[model samples]
Target: MEKLDHIDLAILKTLQENGRISNADLADRIGLSASSCSRRLDILEKSGVISGYHARVSHKALDYKMIVIVHISLSGQFAKTLAEFEAAVKRVPNVLVCYLMSGEYDYILRIACKDLEDYERIHRDWLSALPHVVKINSSFALREIIDRPNLAASLGS
Candidate 1:
């Protein structure tokens, strides 16, 4: 990971806002020549700083109307148990994100579903069937307040 200089930071900030921005436009916005901007962008991509570009889509647009936050407590924290749990979670299609936590809960999952009935089905069929799970607590998100995929704030402006 190379240290980000001023130009690199500016490039990252601009790209974060609009990944589809043309190279020439990006260069103009950041006060860099097109060739210089292209080189820097190439370096950024090669170094894994600019992982990939993507279109942000609303879950609701895809018929997923509910977001559920689930906290899972495992009966044990053995390596095999954790591995099995993680692998099993990956097989579940509606589990958007899963994290191993350090506190009271063993794992936290963000799940998307169509409705309460769909969530109930997931809870009964998938979450409960996971190995080593002792308890599962779930809460529905009323609404999404903020969801930013950019890390521009870490660059210190």
Candidate 2:
């Protein structure tokens, strides 16, 4: 991919703020003609700079009141073991985000539930069933201070 210039950066910033913005408005914002802006967007998409867009939904409104962060340490870090664990996690509905990290724990998962009982079911039925799980620790969120994915903006678009 080519290095992004100021216009590309501006385009990314605008799209992140409002993904539904029309091409004409985007051109207006970035001081370009509609066709030129459309071409840039096409190139951005083709080059994989712009992956996709999604709407942010309120979990509270959906009655998903509990947030749990699960830290997992595996018995081993073999490729097969990690892949199996991740694939199982994908099948579990409550699991929202999972990250493989370096440090004391092998993996971290962010989960949502309706309440403590719901969490218990996930702990017992879903998470606990995984093989080669050496240690499992869970922390329930008391309050959500800041919750945004904090999408990349400083990467020069």
Q: What TM-score does each of the candidates earn?
A: 0.93, 0.92
lDDT of the candidates, in the order given: 0.93, 0.90
When summed lDDT is taken over every stretch of 10 residues in candidate 2, the lowest stretch is: 148-157
lDDT of 2: 0.90
Worst 10 residues of 1 by lDDT: 148-157
lDDT of 1 by residue, 1-157 (tens): 6788988999999888888999999999999999999999999999998889899898999999999999999989999999999999999899999999999999999999999999999999999999999999999999899887788735755
lDDT of 2 at 72: 96
Segments in model 1 whose C-alpha atoms lie over 4 Å from true places: 153-157
